[model samples]
Target: MRVAVTGSTGRLGSALVAALADAPFTGPRGPVAWTRADLDLDAPAGVVQALDRDRPEVVVHAAAWTDVDGCAREPELALRRNGEATGTLAAACAERGIDLLVVSTNEVFGGDREDHTGYAPSDPTAPPNAYGRSKLAGEQAATDAFERAGAMGSASLGIARTAWLFGPPGRDFPHKILDAAARALAEGQPLRAVDDEWGTPTYAADVADAIVELLAEDALAGVHHLVNGGIATRATWAEDVLGRLSIDAPVEPVPGTTWARASVPPRWGVLAATPLPSGEPMRSWQAAMADYA
Candidate 1:
């Protein structure tokens, strides 16, 4: 299978590149890779042209404007990068008979968090922030394009949504918390983190592994949450990282509202795999973070 991957140097994208290297896949010229400089998704016409040049059998559309607060400040940039960029890629993939696997987010749902019931893939989506709304728009655009292509002939599309991802090669929540702990340890202060924000932290490597599996399995399509098995609060995750670091520092738990400078996430964003995959559940965030440093 020939595969082209966008965001090829991102935390998740780099992980995908590593995972695909071991698999029985190759690109037209070789391992197809596109960093931001290689494919500026904000100007989406370049993406279509690049894909047309690569002419791969499959494309993993992982690039997007993911800064939440940044999105709120510049909603147009968010929509153009996350929404228009995705539409261009989807439409091009459909026209060229290329399979597309778009990476989405858990923020796409803003339902009652008190329900505690993890979100199913079939649930209706209503994002609470510009970032989430733009991502949802991208998902809808990709789905519509794939459906239209299917109506015309054969085309595969999968939207793999994840949340609170952490690992090497990028700055994630766990890394932030780790940095906080180091500073606190040095200053002899307690770490302050929000206990109200609940979400399942995921390992980028694990999520990337699932994406490769999904792309290989043409039978599986549509939205799927490829997160760790369970959920935990931000404070809990921070405390766990501290514990893993063997740092006996005190932690001050606060509500997410106190930490919300621009946008506040729902109380719960835990995602469940609607239909179980062939492999075991992804390793817990803590387990993955133990090797993060």
Candidate 2:
């Protein structure tokens, strides 16, 4: 199949690209890697033109305005870039009879829920912050486009929502915690983490693998949640990382409100994975972190 991946240079996107190359359905051309220069979301009108040119059988839309705090500060820009731009791409794909899978976030749910088991794919969405609101809008737009495109022969639309992605050697949470632990030990202070906030810490590689498997199975329609099997708060996740590294520096737990940020992340952003092709949930974050470490 002729597959195309957007945000190909990013952490998760890079993993997806690598997975596709190793996938059974990968064509001789492999996956088309598109950076912002190739398909800028800022210019929505050119989306269809690009789609026509690439003529990809499947387009995995991973590009987004990922700066949560920045999105909170400039909500309108967030909506334009993440929401409206996605709608344009979805409409374009629908018209061309191309299957599309949009990468989404756990933040789409209002995190204020008392339940901790994790949100299901069919749960009602109620975003608590600006970034979540924008992503939810994108999801709605994509669904709307699919509905409008009557009798889309082989076309399918999938939404894969993930949470607290951490992977790639020096760019994510584990590395950040290591750095913070080093600093805290040197300064004789404890590393502080938010205990009140809870979510799954998913490995990018795992999510990418799951996505490739999903595509191979032709299960690209409806909402899917791809996350690690278990859940953890920021503090517990940090402790796990530190324990794996044998770091002895103490990690202090604090409320989410202790550190003020422009955006509010979902407190309980955990998402239960939909039944995967193998009929098994993804491995636990601890196991994934071990490989990453």
Candidate 3:
């Protein structure tokens, strides 16, 4: 199948490209087109036009305005990328009878929820911050497009929500933490991290693999949570990452309130997938972190 992956330049998108490079459906004879350009989220109309011209069998929508704090500061840009862009892609896919897979976020759930363990697919969505709100809007827009295009066929939309993604060649939490640790060690400064915030850390490679599996499975439609199996606070995660990297930086535990951020981060928004026919759950965050380190 000819697949078009948006945001092919991002960490997760790049990983997906690597995974698909050797995929059975994308070998020397198989069909695959990996693009990091032309489908820019900033130009939704241009993206739709490109998709219409390419007429790919599947469209993986991965581009988005992911800066959480930046989203809070600039909601208009967030809505444009996360919300309007989704609708445009979904509509384009619906018109061509192509499968549209939208990569979403765990932040859609209000972080204020008391249950920090994790969120389920059925859980209610109440975004606590602007980022979450924008993502939720994107989800709704995709769903609405699917509903309006019911005449096309059965469920052409797939929402794969993940969290705390980290890997090589991308600006992610693990890289940032390790960079900070190295700087602190070099400057003889102490590294401080928030112990209050909690969530699952997903590896970009694992997530890319899961997306391929989901696309191949016929029964894997609708909303699904895709993340690493385990959960941990930022402090614990930082310490584990440092330990794995053989770094001896002392990470000080600090509360979320102590950070004094402008927006209230979700105390907990970890997620668990609702079981797939492949019977494979996401790898544990610890295991993923080890590989990432």
Candidate 4:
């Protein structure tokens, strides 16, 4: 099918675009991408214009103001992009009878429940920060828009709530850690990372695959957490990267207070794709890392 994707150059969007191009159902139009210049979220009205221009049957809404701390400082700007623009896009998609598949976040849940396994799909959302709140608002808006508009015959809505996204060659955690380890090793210095925060490390390519799978399923609806199958502290993940690189330097654990930010993210924001099809689970982060390496 004809597919239009937003945020074509973003960490996850690029992967989705590539995956869509390789997907079995992608049409001759291919996966049309609309960057910020093409569809400015600041101007919600432009969403309709861009959608009209692309005229795709499915729209993967991946663009968002992702600066978490920046969003906390400027909720209005964040909401305008993450919330209002999403509503506009959803409404436009509904009007055009196009399927809407959106990228949501694990931050929507109050990640304060550290002792728990993780947030499930059925859990009641309680966003702690503006970024999360805006994302939650967008999710609600998308659902309402689809249900109200009654997606033209077979058109539907699918929400992929992913977390701690990584997996780009020079942008993923492993790359950064490996780079730092290489540099530090050259200078004989110790590595340090935050230990307090914990979350799943989702590979962007894997998540993109999951998103394509989600879109293929016409019966799928509502939210689905599309993250890797494991969780770990920031420091531990760093250690794993270091070990894989065969770097002898030890990484010291630091607390969150060491880094000052306007927003306070959840301490344990692990995500679980509850009620998923039995015998289907995301591959482990370690396995994904191995593939990336």
Among all candidates shown, the one with the greatest TM-score = 2
TM-score of each: 0.93, 0.97, 0.93, 0.91
List where candidate 3 sits over 4 angstroms from the true fold: 27-36, 151-155
TM-score-better candidate, 2 vs 3: 2
**lDDT tens digits, residue span 1-293, model 3:** 66777888787888887777667775464334445366666777776667667767887788888888889888888888899888887877776688888899988988777745578888888988888888889988888887788823644788999988888676678778989998898999889999988888888899888888876775446888888888888999999988887889999998988866656667887886667658978778888776766
Per-residue CA lDDT of model 2 for 140-188, tens digit only, reads 8888887798625559999999999998734688888889999999999
Clashing pairs in 2: none
lDDT winner between candidates 2 and 3 = 2
Checking candidate 4 for backbone clashes, the offending pairs are 1-25
* Candidate 4 lDDT tens digits, 1-293: 78888988898889999998888888655688879876688987777777777788888888999899989999988888999889889888898888888899989989877566888888888998999999998998888787788773557787889888886634577778877777877888777788998898878998888877766655346678888888888888898777776778788798988878798778888998644453488898888877776
Off by over 4 Å in 4: 147-154, 179-189, 275-278
Residue 136, model 3, lDDT: 89
